[model samples]
Target: MTIATLFAAVVRAKPITGFIVEDDPDRPQLARSIGLLHLTMMGVGATIGTGIFVALTTAVPEAGPAVTLSFVIAGITAALTALCYAELASAVPVAGSSYSYAYATLGELPAFLIGACLLLEYGVSCSAIAVGWGQYLNELLAITTGWHIPDALARPPGNGGVVNLPAILLIGMCLILLLRGAKESATANTVLVFAKLAVLALFVGIAIAHFSAANFHPFAPKGMVGIGTAASSIFFSYIGIDAVSTAGEEVENPRRNLPLAIILSLLIVTAAYILVSIAAIGAQPWTAFAGQEAGLAVILHNLTGAAWPAVLLALGAMASIFSVTLVVLYGQTRILYAMSRDGLLPKLFQRVDGRRGVPRQNSYIVAAGVALLAAVFPLDVLVNLTSMGTLIAFAAVSIGVILLRRSRPDLPRGYRVPLFPILPIVSAGFCAYLIVGLPADTYALFAVWIAAACVIYFGYSIHRSALA
Candidate 1:
């Protein structure tokens, strides 16, 4: 192959219209019973957990009481990419999410790399959240009962012990719920979403009563750099807002509902995060947050002089994080299923159970892969991978929005990005800034992964893809 031929092969793009397809009966046929409510809940359930539930300990110290502002800065950054997702999801409405958009608007190689990013964003994040779930479960256990899971079983390899039993068990349970079908899984997630919200409301209701204006003094004690860095760290919490786009096939009124759900969920999540951050910071001295893993619960415990509050918060974290793991894992499977259907992956991944209307094989494969990751790897390594993959995938989607607008303006969009070319340009640029801000080690690993994905695309995906 000459350089020109290889370049042509790599840049070949897919048709920029229609739902998921090659106009073949053998391809997947997903049921569309999910309404706007469930789709929005899917986004909320995926977004509102680990970052708020666990990461505050690290974030608050960086900015003092102004970590609340960090949440806003982080949210604005997420909102930019989210607008891109909203516009693309409205226009495209495919289960492949950003990857499908890239294939249609960018090129096969970019699409393949976006697919890789989605795996890290969804699968690795799922593993990391599940690890969080295990920790909180142990917290809940120790608070409610006299005992907790042994470290030998609870900790992941190299972190402390042989394996993470509780994390895998959490994934196993979610797998069972998912195999029941999409509607059922969404229903379960909806319930969990509400449960966690009520728990958060309880925390806020109690904590806000003790709000001291004095605590917010010297806000941004470490200044704007600290706030920005904290925002970068907590931006992962804003993820899963795009998880709504991954369920395009399973959603009713795809164009309207997908975009509506994505934006609405982000709005809801940002509001909740800001409210919680304000309440937590106002109720306690900023210096007191440095090492409190259960910060919010500790706030409650301090206010009421009780252990029950911490136990309840622990229960909430466990349930809420379980929902995060479930939704993200679900997103991962649907993405691979789309890749397989497009011939970028093995056919086995696209195999759907006709009776269940779910890609059982894809779900099982993703769950098994992530469960193993959760059981063996510690959370520290996984967190940066999630952020890097997430930002790159988001950046690609922002770029895709501009390209698609220029290439196919004739297509009716359910939601047009408010500011047109400028919004998409800035969205992509912000994503680039965040990606560049990631640690050097993270950048090196991300480059390696992209390189490897390019090899797979050149050696296999290029030839295998019908769309390419």
Candidate 2:
């Protein structure tokens, strides 16, 4: 191909309002049935998983009692990006999350690249949370029945054991629910989110009753450096806020519900995170947080010598992680469906079940991919990479907001980011700053994933693109 032809093929942008072409009878379109409540539940279900439940062990050790400060910093960064995402979702309501926004604003090449980054964010998040579910399930079973799942069944290869059966089983369960339909899945998620919140509230209530002000001494023992690093890590907990946007096509009244869900999800999750961090730190010395496989349960165990609180925490965690896996898996399948519809991926992803009005095959494919990772990879290996991917995707959405504002000022936006370009600029900058704090290996893995995506784009997608 000539240089001009190559540039034209790669840089051509999709129209912001043209993502869903539902006129064709044979074409499978996602069903729009989710209301505002369901959308918020999705955001909640996807956002509050392993990050708060399992990550405290690592985050507390890094920042001591001031990990609460880290939670605030991370929450602020997420709020900025969530606002940018809200504007984009209102302006260009589509199924693919930031990838679709990039396609409509930044062109096809960037869309393909952003789509790959989202795979890391959502896909790895599903795996990591499912692995966490395995640990919590073991704890619950051990407490209730005196029999824990063997390490060979509970752990992944890198974690010094065989396949993680419970993790894979959890993914399979979610796959079945998603294939059933969006409403069923949404209802299940809503129930799980409330249950998860109740358990968290119980923990905070109990922890506060035992709050020892002395445990907070030397609050910044590790200094600003540690707080910043811990903020970067805690950022993972905020990953699912964008899942609200990913369901644009499936939501009722997309323009209105999308932005409301995004904002509320951010506020709710952030407040819970800050409160939980404070209660946990105040209840016990920060030093006690490290090396606990299930941090919250361990905290409860310490506080009440009775095993019941720990058992309750474990049961709550199992339900919480299950919801996370379901929502993250749902997000990934919807994104892939959008990409496939645009001819950037195989047609298989976009195929919906006629009776159910949901993408059964796509859900299965995503579940298998997530299950493989959950069965093989260790938790730490999956967590940092997910944070790196999320930071890049957040930056892309922030930049897309700015670009869309400049290019399509006349376009009707249901929600506009206040202060013009300021929010988008700050959001992008903050996300980039967090990206830099990640381990170098995470960056290298991201580079490899994006490079592989580019190669696929050139080799197959370019020739078959719908725009072509």
Candidate 3:
């Protein structure tokens, strides 16, 4: 093909009007049972899990007592993206999440690319959450029964151990719960969110009792570079702030409820994360954070010289991480199901069980993929992969908000971002900066994933797409 022809083919945009018009009669319809309350709980459920509970072991060592500042930086970046997400979710109100927004605003190629990135955001996140669950589950067992899973079976292969059985089992259990249906899943998630918040509140209440000023002496021991690096790593904790947007189709009165839930969920999650970080650092010196598998539980055990408090924290981690895995896994399946219906993926993914009103086959496929990664890979590798995918998706959504405003000025929007182009510009810029902060090896892996996605699209999906 000539250069002109190739460039024209690649940059051509999908029609805004046609893409937004629903046409497929056989397309699976999700039950629209979620309210503002359920949506808010889901966002909280997805956000508060493994990221805070398991990530500190690495983040604290990087920034010392300044880890609190790292949380602030990450929260700002996430808030920017959340604003963009809210505006788009209110306008689009669809099932495919950001992928659907990109199709309506950007084009087919961009939508396909963003869909590829979401595989990492949700799939790898489930793996990371499951790994954390394994660590906390073992800790809880040891504290109460004086016995734990053998290290050889508890840790992943990359951690110099055999397959992580507990992580695999955790994914399997979530898969079963998901197959039961969405309403049941949402109810379970709501309960889990409250239980998680209560446990963290308990931890803060107890830890502050033993707060020490000595831990704050050299707060930024590693300097600004360390804080930036820690903030980039800590960004993983905020991944689920967009979970509310993913359920736009199911959310009641989506226009108003979607944006409200997104904003409210962010505020609640940010406060919880900041309070936990402060209490943790105050309770114990930051230098001792490194290499501790279950950092929070270890801190409580060391502080009180008692097993009960640590066991309580461990129980909370297990419940919280399990909920995270369930919600993230659900997000992955729904995104793929949307793609399948659009003829961009195999149709098998689009099939939903008529009676159960759930995508049963899709759940099984996601479960197997998530369980394999959780069973073999180390936590750090899964975490960086998840963060990279989310940062890219966030940048795309910010850009989409700008494009849609220009292309469809006549469209009605229930929620408009406060500072039109500036918020999106800053959101996209910070997302790019965080992506750059990731290790070179991670960038290489991301490049490979994108290239693979391109090959798949050009070889099969492009010709088969419903748009074609």
TM values, all candidates: 0.96, 0.98, 0.97
lDDT against the true structure, per candidate, is: 0.85, 0.89, 0.86
Candidate 1 C-alpha error for residue 235, in Å: 1.0
Candidate 1 vs candidate 2: the TM-score winner is: 2
Compose the digit string of candidate 1's lDDT tens values, residues 245-297: 99988899998999889989999999999999999888999999886755676
Scored by TM-score, the top model is 2
Q: Write the per-residue lDDT of candidate 2 for residues 1-468, one digit (tens) a residue.
A: 999999998899998657645446777567899999989989989999787898998899999999999889888899999999999998888799999999998899989989998988999988989999988888787777889889998999978789999998999899989989998999999999999999999999999999999999999999998898888877888987878888988898898999999999989999989999899999989998887788888788889987899898898898999998889999999999989999999999989898898988888889999999999998887888989889989999999998988898998889999987888899999998788778888878878888899899999999989889
Q: What overall lDDT, based on C-alpha atoms, would model 1 receive against the true structure?
A: 0.85
Winning candidate number (lDDT): 2
For candidate 1, the per-residue lDDT at 282 reads 85
Model 3, position 97: C-alpha lDDT score: 82
In model 2, state the lDDT of residue 407: 93
Clashing residue pairs in candidate 2 (N, C-alpha, C atoms within 3 angstroms)? none
Cα deviation in Å at residue 314, candidate 3?
Answer: 0.7
